[model samples]
Each structure stands twice: as C-alpha cells, then as structure tokens.
Target: MGTLSPAAPPTTPERTKSRLLEAVKDCDCATAQALADKLGVTVPAIRRHLQDLQDAGQLEVRTEKPGGRGRPQHVYVLTEAGEATFPKAYATLCVDVLDQVERLFGDGAVLRVMDARRLEFQGVLASRLAGHSDLGRKLTALAAVLCEYGYAARAYQENGQWYLTQRNCPAPAVAKAFPQLCQAELTLYRDLLELPVSREARLSCGAAECRYKVG
Candidate 1:
C-alpha cells in the first residue's frame, strides 16, 4: 500500500482491480476512500472496482453500528475465494512426512502425530487466551491468533451464540490427505476454549470456509 503508482481509469481495470484487492487484503482498507488513498486512485474509481470485486464474490461488506449520526459504516473484508488469490505458505514437505507416517506406521500412528501437533497449538492458544474469562472475549482472542497463524479467522455472534470461521487453512494438503488433522483441529478448539465447540462447516468437506459454533 506504499506509494503504489496509479493506473489510468478503466483502461487498466484488471491491473487496478488486482492492486485494489491487495490493498483490501494487506492494508485492511475497508472503505473506498481509504483504498483510494492507498492505491493513489480517485474515490469513485475505487468504488467501481470495489463493486466489481463484491459482485464476483471476492469481498463482502459488513455494516457496523453508526458511531454518531447518519447511516452505519460499511466495511469490506475478503471472502475465502478472495483469500485464495494470495499465495499459500503451507509446506508440502509436511505432507510428504505425513504420507510416510501412514506408510511406515499405521493409520493410528498418523492420528497420534496430528494429535501431538494439536496439543502443542492448544497450549499456545490457551495461554494467550487465558485472561479472557468471558466466552465472547475468548473467541475474539482466538480469532486474532488464528489470523496470525494464516487461518484468516473471524469471530462473531449470531442468534446469541459465538462462532469462529476460518477462510484459509494453513495446511490445506495435510488436511486433505489426512482426515485425522481435521479432527485434531476440532479437538484443539474445543479443548482450548473449554466449551463444546461444534463444527458447522469444514473446508475439507468442500466448504469455502470452516465454521465452528460455541455451545
């Protein structure tokens, strides 16, 4: 988002749109004005690109409560598909190791390895989220850490229940190759949050996002 040279209007819409998407994802520019400033483009031009991205299902808007008067503020965030536009940093080497695990040992040994990884992550998450006694606060803290871990996670409330959704999986190949990793991941969340966390959707099952509900 630093001093990006602006492209001329509509002529280079694709290039401009690509830059705009990067601004939204990396710079967290939720507003048209902010995106314009970051990309060195006009507000109206930015708005057009924003609409195009939204129509393509790459981004979604959330209308937050108004701070003062007037209408609520609309903020845009990347959808799972949008997150897919970026490069994934998962190590294929891990997948190779996991495959060897299944070959040399048995299915039980593979589950044990994934479980061990889950336990380590559980300890890290629990320690960071320890001070948040309330369920909502704990969920929010969990989201922050998940994002840091490249999960692109969000925490929100619906129907008086807290939810966690991850748009990106750090180890997509590992998850796809071994169902045990997915199960271990669910177990980690339940154990760390100390609640009966139920999975509503899973990326492994062809869902765009992986969703969990706190009960």
Candidate 2:
C-alpha cells in the first residue's frame, strides 16, 4: 500500500490580515468594500481582518463624508507600526555602499558622501519650494516631496506652530547606522523651511515615527 500524501496548509486569518495590510500599504487608505472588491473577498471578511489589525494597533480608521451620501464611510490606513512591517532595501544597500567606501578609503570618505547627498537634496528642495513664502504652504510642499521619496510624510499645525510627521522611513537601517543622515535631513528641513526646525522624535532612536517641529 502506498503512503498517503500530506494535506496542503490551509489559509488562516493571519494570512488574510497580511493581505489586507498589503492592500492598505499600496494606497493612502481603503474601505472594507473597496478592499473586498480588490481582494475578491466579502465585506464581512475584510472587516474581520481589519478589526484584527486595529486590535493589534497596526491600523487606523478615518471617516470620510461622501459627497452624495447617506452615511460616512470608514477608511483604513496603516499606522507607523504597520508600515514598519513592509520590506525595505534602501537602508541595507546604503550601509553596504558606505561600508565599501570606508574600506576603500577611510571614515572621512563616508562623511564626504553624506555631505554630497545633503547638498543634492538641498538643491532639489530649494527648487521645488521656490516662490512659496507662506510657512504653511512650504511645509506642505516639503511633506509632498518627502512622500514622493517614500517618507509617507504629512504636515499639520497645533498651537500656532507647524509640524511634519513621517510615518515611514525609506532608509531606517542606514539612518540607524549613520547618524549623519538624520542630521542632514534635519538640516534640509531647516534650510528649506527657513525656520528653526527641531527633531521631536526619531525612528532611528527607537521612536514609532520621526517628527519635526517647524516654527
């Protein structure tokens, strides 16, 4: 008699939750109905997974007022904790290149490279933010540029002070390895905003996200 073959592994709620998270990652936010349509699942199933993510502090819900609506729709976005679960290669590649450069020359070579990057970023940001005199608008434009570079940045104000919060870091590993990168980013913000910008929290220093206070 031949031995029986092993059964295939069944998909669990965890896998479903992962898929939901991935879908949310690709978009700014998603609704259960939208996610159901995208994933070919029922609304109830999508809600279940979303609830699980929320319970685990991985997702946030926002209500949107529909234009011709009867009721508001709930939109889900990945929290910083959730965004951290995604894959990031920029940090690893950056560290590898810096290591190679250091081995080829010296520690000073790494500083030069970082300074060069700072100058390039400054030029680009200056160009993008030109002709914007309003502090609020400048910060918004800066946030948009940062988002384009995978920072997931947003700008807001409280107590008459402007702030920028970045939910995701494209180079967490690199920033953790090289503090200069973080300083350079701070400098970039200060220069571009033409305001005194202080880093309130840093992902590299074990914070959930990086936040900057701009005046």
On lDDT, the candidate that comes out on top is 2
Looking at model 2, the pairs that clash are none
For model 2, how does the per-residue alpha-carbon lDDT over 16-100 read when each residue is reduced to its tens digit? 8888899998755498888888888999888888898999999999997666566888989989999888876766787999889
Question: Per-residue lDDT of 127-187 in model 1, one digit per residue for the tens?
Answer: 8997899988889999999999999999999989889999998777778888898899999
Kindly provide the TM-score of model 2 when superposed on the true structure, using C-alpha atoms: 0.59
TM-score of each: 0.58, 0.59
> What residue runs in model 1 are displaced by over 4 Å at the alpha carbon?
1-91
Pairs in clash, predicted candidate 1: none
Top model by TM-score, which number? 2
For model 2, the stretches where C-alpha displacement exceeds 4 angstroms are: 1-6, 10-90
